[model samples]
Target: MGGLNSNAELRRLLEEIGWSPYELARAVNRLVSPDRRIHAKTPFAWRDRGTVPRDPLPAVVAGILTEARGEIVTVDQLWPGQAHKTEVWLPAVAQIAPDRWLPHDTLALLKEFRASGKAKTHFAVSGNELTSLAESWAFGNHALMSNRMTAGQGRITPDYIDYLEKDLAELRRLDDGHGGELVLRAVVNRLAEAIDLLSDSSYPADLGRRLLSLAGQMAQLAGWLGFDLGRHGFAQRMYLLGLRAAVAAGDKQLGALVLSCIAFQQTWRNRPHDAVSIMGTVQQGLRSATTPRVQALIAMREARAFATSGMHSETSAALERAHQALARGQHDHDPAWVYWMGPTVLTSEAGRCYLHLGDTLQAEQQLAEGLANLNQDATRDRVLYGLSLALAHARGTGGRQDLELACYEAGQVLPMLPEVGSARCRNLIDTINAELRPHRATSTVRTFIDKFETMKKAKIC
Candidate 1:
């Protein structure tokens, strides 16, 4: 594997694409942050020998660099031989019949990313040292926690969060074919060990916030699967646990974020009013929180809640608050969690909120802008965004091609459900169908329905 020559390759690719480094930076910045000014520092970090990008960005950089060079750099080229053609990260790596392909395309995607990026470094999941720690903690007495509990090591590093996000993606794939039940059971077992560590461990007192935040995330993940499976009661309970853990961790922001999961769960239950109320809890927490990133998330969730409940005015107001909150985020925020609260997320949330309010024009515009800013590898988020896009097209029922494309993206979650129990995603499918029902005889609409059927058939979630 080459020394993650991302910088060197990026430099070369710039020339190959007839683009200047500043130009590329400007493009990415514009996409990522059209409102708050984008600075040159955002994209130049790719060349820094000592720096590695966060989750979605590294994958985004791989694609962008490859597109400019007119060739694929590949995860292997960037990271190297640690991963294989059959890696589960890729969808094609899984060679099974579509019917029996419980987790079809498990390794199909990793390959695409690998092929697109030049060998930057051999940053395979297998090479992660955190695996051992996670596995060990899984079997440990306190494994019930995931730093989300109340103790143990916290914030291993910014990179650790990225690795964990990758792990979550892998888990999503497995959950598709096998069902979220299997994934939940497995995570529960592993989390038990984490709980043991938290209960028995003693560490720097300052680590408490990190541990609680991580543990809350784990609980939130568990709740998401539960929501997907229609286990409304279970999901709500899990969310409560995660929420409490978040508070104990002294991460009111993360706690509010966890509550957003619950708000989403309520939406899935067809209880939009309940969803609205749940988000209220999130709003209070956000008010007391320090960071704008957390506030953005809280506001976005509130916007979603209001929109789904048919409160057009409230939805717009909440969305405005979401933008205002995001505007407050400076580059100096903690790179780990805060980086996720980028412009893409803000716009996507606003778009989603608007979609539910039946404002197709506003939703369409926000969705387009948000997608342009988003990375391709954030599979879970991408899937939901596609749902929003489909809704945008369905307003007048003429977007057959667009609907079909959205169907393809929805397949990204085939055999695996997202851990972010979002009632809204499923609702989007229903909304699209309702809008197209007047023309169900059309082939494109028919195909879309067929996929929708498949989604519905995913029993037990």
Candidate 2:
């Protein structure tokens, strides 16, 4: 057991945490399903016999240790030399340089991302790092770079810019319908193309600014796709790069848009304070030229942050500002990215905020209105908002739970689940199933469980 195959690191970590092998196994089991549960003695084999646990166990164990220690732990640290197979890769934030947002840095990142293949290491930016980046963009007073003709053969024109913008819009539409997994590679490719043009092409100052803005837009979209796919570290890197591009273009509004995206990711990661801070940076940066729609979008994100942090009064005030901003109507100078930030999208987000705030009735009302008005082609949104509605119904008002209505609402989203490939949507479905498990005696809950299981197995098959 003390020979070449010994896992000294695993044993050391177990000792440091003061956890017995059985305790580690129990922790892993809690995070996984009953059928996938490991034996109580499994960690003994791992630590003493140097046996590496299969598939997700290593990652799960690492996560357990991370939570217990209040720090980041990785599978590689637990089982050295073992191939890591994790659902989501969370790399150390320090591994990514804080200032890697310049044009050459972005090119290198794109090259690395393209070459990394399927087993890419995802690096999450620390909250402090994100805040610093936001502050830099907001107050750095970044001036547009003077036009310099590069030696490469690519030539950019207004017609080309128009075509690129339309192509990006189309990519957004595809993502809305099919989710990130289906569209991520395409987005990366487009972002790479845009970067190449920015780095290799010779254009006038105006065209150069336009190209930079386009690159920022592409980076923002790619970042969002990465987030939707649960590659958060990769998402943050793209977001930082996008912010850099926006600054280079002297596009304060685009920079604010990128910051809002970062704030959204922070909210999802349960760092509401960081989200609120980033949103504040966005709001402060855009105080002069922000359009009504843009303001509404920013306020909605701020409201989400407040809701996540349990700031009821602040959340209400932010939502009111969002609604009031929308009431100002669309401005002629509104950015193209705010095209989707209308009543329907705002209502859905407000519903999400209320859901976080534990007001299930209000959540249900807002989500239902949003769903009813949602475009039929917005399959991913429907699944997300629909699942939120189901949760609200499951929780119900006062002391009552509407199991039947909950199942019905969830069932409505079941068929559309396969149409999109979002991990978030899948996670929400799992959450709903978990919530409904207690009422398994009820026929409605039983039927929903059966259908969900059948669909899950079918996907595997």
Score candidate 1 by TM-score against the native. Answer: 0.52
Q: What is candidate 2's lDDT per residue for 110-169, written digit by digit as tens?
A: 455445524544456446667877877676655575666655687788999999999999
Native-vs-model 2 lDDT?
Answer: 0.80
Off by over 4 Å in 1: 1-186, 202-213, 285-289, 331-338, 397-437, 447-461
For every model shown, what is its TM-score relative to the native structure?
0.52, 0.82
* Ten-residue stretch with the least lDDT total in model 2: 89-98
Clash-forming residue pairs, model 2: 123-233
Instruction: List residue ranges in candidate 2 displaced over 4 A.
Output: 1-119
